[model samples]
Target chain A: MDPLSLLRGLLDTTEDAARALVGRERIRLAVTGLSRAGKTVFLTSLIANLIAAGRGARTLPALSDATGGRIRRVFVVPAGTETVPRFDPEAHLGALAADPPRWPERTEDFSTLSIAIDVERRTSLGGLLPERRLTLDLIDYPGEWLLDLPMLRQDYATWSGETLARFRRGVRAAAAAEFLAFLDALPADAPAEDALAKRGYTLYRDALRACRDAHGLRFLQPGRFLNPGPRGEAPLLWFFPLPEGARGGLADLCARRYAAYLDDQRSTFLDPYFSRFHRQVVLVDVLGALHAGEEAFRDTGDALAAVASIISGANWLERLLGAAPTRVAFAATKADHVPTRARDALAALVEHIAFGARGRAAQSGAAVSCHAVAAVRCTEDAVARLEGQAVAAVRGVLLQDGRGATIYPGEVPMKPPEPDFWDAGLFTMPEFRPPRLDPAGTSGMPHLGLDALLAWLIGDLL
Target chain B: MSGRPTPRVILDEGTAPAPRLDFGWEVQVAPPVPPARGWSTMALIGLGAAVLVLGFSLLEAGNFVAAQFAQAAWLGWLTLAVATAGFGLVFVAIGRELRGYLALGTVDRARAAVARGDPAALRSALAAWQAGLPEGRAKPGDLGNMPINAACALVEAKTLAPIAQDAAALGRAAAVQAFAVTAVSPSPALDALVFGWRGIRLVRQVAALHGFRPGIAGTVSLLRRVAVDAATVAATDVAVDAAVRGLLSSRLAEHVAGEAAAGAVAARRMMLLARAADEACRVLPR
Candidate 1:
């Protein structure tokens, strides 16, 4: 470690920092969604289409300048990182290209995939200027995990009170009845013990599961409680919301554990990873929530509002470190579930549901856009005749029974469904299997609105 | 699903319905994939044939001049004067072909400057483009208000869009003319002659509209550069489409309808070439 060498090392670090401040070389795109909101499929399709674009077939038409000729080449290259596993698009693509063509497996942990886009920027000094390299560092994390970052703001008592209050309200009461009975039996000031903590954690988790799995709720929070990462259950996770009492025993113990949990997350997840996002995409399953009836729909709307604010209002730490996402895209995923004509209504519905949040995010200087996207088009538009008249419908291989079916899923309502809308119950939707794909991956997948999303995300750079 | 705020389902008061934001360019417009197709033997053959014809016509004129010299003196003098004028006219035509190259070069250099983003180049390109505007046009849509850089960036949208659009219209018209003449003409030779003339005429008109006046030879050169891909399409895919249409129409109508499909196939190629020519002439935002 000579003094000259050390100084040179410092200078090298300085140049790298300077480049990172303004260089458009490596851009991190953070993508997350709710549970089963199609996060894995979206990332996989995005990578596959880009790779195909390299070989002459590109479905990304909105990126006119890039796909038309400006892009010299595009390919998914393995990212070199030690912290997280390299994202394997091949495995996901293989699953979708399976004989029966199934959806890819859900994201279990964070992964990184790098796409190298060699762009010929003719705008500044056409042929004489060198080609620019843009590496799209795509960060894919479990949709169930991102929502937990927002939880760090609240302490154990505030969170406990809110959870208890939710349990006492509307449809949650019935879903959490067994949990509520268990809560009523335990005294808040009971002595701290491993068995008691485990019992409470199990009961509260079951309640969240019932609300989500059985009742089709969207926003069950402390998302780690639902999908507890690769480590499964650490000791700190064995805490649950409790009724108010003297703050001396069990309540104090749980509060300490909650603080420890937040500290662990802040070091391992927030600062190093989430804070580095240059752009963010929040995917919402609005159609699935709509199918769950009014209660679930409203619940989803609340979750989106919270997310919008969080996206726009990055904590002071993230902002100070220049990690606030400059642009945020709210995507209504699985758009192939609806007919093409009604796709607009589907976007409008989501917009109206979260209008306030979107406007605020935009005001806060994050370029916000809403889009209806189908990563892999699972259905084809068809005219289904009912009573000797034609109606808009989608025909696909239904996931329910591995058979082809045409379903007129009804007009996606322009605004939120009217009061008593559930009485008709006609807006129910079913999922579909992935479309067949080329085994060798030469042809790009047919998609809806992904080009628009990509264009908004990085069209200027191209 | 519980403890959510009471949902307020209401549209905006008196606000218009929001515009559709699902703009996927793939569905709205199919981008032109003009693959670089090198000059085929047919193109070379056409050029060679054209050169031979021109050579023979000049030789015939030479022979007439020689014949006049052997006739009566006054009649020979009159014949000599007419032949000399014809030779001068051919030279003048060649000069216009040179002018054609010059005019095309002016825009090409300015276009390169714009791409380079040189401030001086931007200003020069602006002046050159402004000078080329059609008479009585009201400043070509806000170019007068824009800064030089801004002007060049949106040169296509503000200045060249209308020109490109009109060029497209002309392309379509030429295509229709080709289709009509091909369908009605009794001979395949007539169809070929008419299509070639129409394509040449379109190239000249489109180039002239962008401020270049090329002679027949120059027009053909420009045509070759722009029409390479279209010619390939006509040779390959368009023929397939025409064949499909021909088969479908054969069951529906008699003799003439079958040729109409082939006519349409030729028209499709002409339209594609016209589009390429339009793009080839545009000045900025490359």
Candidate 2:
């Protein structure tokens, strides 16, 4: 490089640095969760409420009060990158506001949105200071993709061994029957053939889909095989886990594809987005997992642990060059599905599920906390008479029929349920219809514990 | 048990040539050079000098003998030190504030470019921001792949346009019946069945377009498979509705009804075909 060019570069860097030091601070908030964990809803409500609160609507009491009423204004800003898709808040909000409200489509790929809030300084002698603006960038991605991070550290053989072993037990075994049969028919050293590869890939992909949809399993890997987004129908995603201790042309082919898949995942997914997140909110459907069965519950826990390991155990090169230390919050979603009285139990269950990950994060000098929240409250507390005794219940519109009903869902255990509890019968969690909202604005989207969540996430920043 | 040799069994020819598997991994390039640290060093020095002078002043004020240094020379020296400290503090504060401002400016510029829907401008702004980062700071990777990706997406969309239009027309016709059935009788099983029927129609249409002619029996078989696939997808949709929308409505009914209106099934099939076409073309002798 020319000396003058170098000097210019140095000057430009310094000037930019100075501007950054003085300008509004930018915070990247990553919203991640397993499929159906309410990440989309949480993000929507959070943004709505934040914008509302900025407009003095007073929806989020904790957040509003914490800002000392200095939030002058808040507004949505254009996303900072063109490579990534922008989160369509308008389309989502419109879906909820339709005549017969419908849910928005689930996130299939990563997206981003940014919000800017102007806050006045609060100090005895700072009355002369101008208001400061803070820009928050929210990144949304599927939790299934996050599960693939561990594959970056594993070779094809090891991943295959572990994956095959996992499917051999529990509900997955039944789902994997067809795929397993196909695997058995092929010899490891057999000549590589396109017909065979496609057949194996399709069978395995079908099994993975069945495992998730039928059995409600959360530990499914190679997530893109199920939700291939823009890379749909691409040859790069046509690889499946092979049987262990197999070496030959077939194994070689699968191994190569596996490596390619990992490369695509890292460069196209994690590096640009996951590695850049400054804060992360992990949403877990604790009640749903628990309802599924013991296997599902344990699988969810393992998924959390794996995600935490990746978040806290970045390689030395990445650690030195990655984004700032991240703050993590694990939120148990759909709190309104259970009764208000069982809220504590729900929180406890989530805490227990996240305990190991939380400990690891704390060890890594990152703050971790758990909360039970409902981004969109659907049910309300009520009482029902059962066997001449009053029992706590929840009243809401039945999702099956638009009729009103009161349900006394079984109790949520405060601790991890014992094996015997499984025999005792699990609670039937009914889905409730969302309450009507003011289509005009975000003033009436009822939520539970969102304020507290906000207080925990960005209270200090306020 | 017969001594005659059994008819020899031979597998059919492969649908396509075996995919290449080079397993050639690309080495990650070296990280970007860290931004210049001259501003940071200068700011630190100024902050340190301010703190030292302020601390000394406080200590001197606490000492009784400090008043004896009120002579012109001593007083002048003290005043000069305090002024210098004030200047240093200002420099530090300005440096910190300016850095933040510059960072925010970069994002603001990028956002503006995006708002204008100018891809070139957005790319340019991003590159400029990356170049402005200090030493040791991680720079964003190349966005050169974005245009190509966008082009591919556009091509795929173009390929599926006509299929989507046809599906939409068919969906409009089915919507009336679907709505009436759903309204009159709300049953999860019934909804699943309706969705399964729609899935069958969709698969038949897609298969026909792809030149795979299936008879009635084959169509029914395909329907069974499509139904299973739709049912699986509905399960996920139901979960998503429960968690996000707080609605317990049957996702199968909703999905079928929605697809009927928007022609998602046909569009989706077209997308799949487009991809397959791309792959097949790639493997063709060229």
Candidate 3:
């Protein structure tokens, strides 16, 4: 390398290329969670902080004097966008500034952002003291993707049969059966009927929801089936032979279409999703899963292992397509639900659920780490005294009757009942939503350990 | 059970491949096959070769092509016709891989923009963001990857050069003073610069290994304390330093240092980030 050339490269531009070069590093990060686990909210908040840092505004404790400088600029890129993800400072700041802060909207698919930061270089490194710009790309996606991973292991028949069976058992099945009967009335070769099609689609979605409610299966998006694009047209549904078929001809056609649906699904959703990601964050609503009962817990354990199996076996598919995720983070969401005192116990529960799957990933040379986090603070405080006994409760704003009121939401039961308990009902009372924090409490609720999560995943980029 | 091995089950040479089994076997019909995809690697290599040739030709001919075209109307017309044909081919290729190319380019640009600074790009981005702010279209999150902070730093350094140099020595002192000016608070730009770098360094270690650094462990423990204890900055600084040192020391060997050297560097960066963050806090209008 010519010193003069280097000098010229250094001096020829005022764009701070020198700083970027000095700061350049690569790190991969994945953010994911179960359905409605506040993945999107956490992502947006983390990004908001990063963007706020860009203005040389806001103070982040981790980035304060003891650590280093804060984030300077932020960019968020939607998966298909030309630019990186941007920190929507307005969205977050506005929310924070509101009389009562609210969580960001949930995300349905994968979103990513690559952030760049320029730090003040320390003088002792024997080089020019130009500030270095470090860039980190943080990737966020739906936790549903983790659920779909297990489907890769099942053939078309198995997936459809199991789903159909579940639908038959659940309360939503009556409506579904009616819809299937309607399917029986349609002619096999008749022109597409919009009304019938809509009914059929409704049935599929309803059945999926039923399964989700009763069985805790989360991937319920209906578009995956109805839209297979040009190549998939009608033939795909042949594999998922609908029981709606009353005659031999109808049965044959249904079988063919089911097959097509399965094939299309494998090609579209299963393959690319596993292949594209370089790392994965599997957010388990373990408490919710646990609360669902023994069967639910067992189901979760099975599902997680099943997901792991597919990922490992999909090596062939990944090789055929591209790189599989090199790392996996099996995170337990709503860590804040427990009193801070029992966070370790919550972590232990998560560790038990993830141990087998994580070990498998490690055996295969893929990196796996576990974390317990609360994307949105459901509780303001770690512990509360209820009826004179100290119970772990979250203190935050809640709805009393129809008005917003302060309340101490009771602690998650130390041991929730069996799987049949989910059938009982969701936690409808305001015990989960606590009292609104005063100005002092607002600082950490929206994001906790998000920085450390960011640090662990893509800190090298900065 | 028909013990005798039923005559239908007996093998016979007469069966003889079942006359090639004309269940559409020899019907001259095509098998069900997906449409062939484009030869990507071949095309890319060819395109690369073409670019190389064109570059070499330009270097060799210098102003020759322009001069030739300028001298004759017929020559210019011929050139235009060739250019049009080339464009048509390009359009066809674009149609084939337009989405893929766009996606690749987007990722590439973001990566390049982050890895290296392009002032024109940064200025354009900054202007867009500033303009987008009022319309509620601007996303501050973009600052994370835009290198805009660095650009702002440079802008501050450049703008404040005369101001800083007036009271100090020229050149180095001016640069140092400019950096100081950039550090002036309420500028999340400087805060991000310091924190983002250390954050990246931290993430790298975490991803690389479990317990990769003693610093992370210490940091985690410190964070545990902070979760419950609202300690002042002075009181917490010691714990922070210890944690940062532990983290930095973990990466020392592979990252161009022994434990001591890495610790020093870590201490310096942590302090720098802390200082900048504090300054931002102070300058943040209450």
Measured over all alpha carbons after superposition, the RMSD of each candidate to the real structure, in angstroms, is 22.5, 34.8, 30.3
lDDT of 3 at A415: 39
The deviation in Å at residue A246 for candidate 3 is 9.7
The per-model lDDT (C-alpha) reads 0.70, 0.65, 0.45
Model 1, A50-105: lDDT tens digits are: 76555445567677544446775677664455678888787778877676566766
Best by TM-score: 1
Query: Which candidate order results from sorting by lDDT in descending order?
Result: 1, 2, 3
Report fnat in order of the candidates: 0.00, 0.00, 0.00
Model 3 / residue B27 / CA error / Å: 81
Error of 3 at A271 (Å): 7.1
Interface RMSD of 1: 17.5
lDDT of 2: 0.65
Docking class of 1: incorrect
The alpha-carbon root-mean-square deviation between model 2 and the true structure, to one decimal in Å, is: 34.8
What value does the lDDT take at residue A81 in candidate 2?
Answer: 46
Q: lDDT of model 2 at residue B235?
A: 39
TM-score of chain A of each: 0.91, 0.91, 0.66
Candidate 2 ranges with C-alpha deviation above 4 Å: A1-20, A79-81, A125-127, A314-324, A386-389, A424-428, B1-286
- Residue B76 shift from truth in candidate 2, angstroms: 83
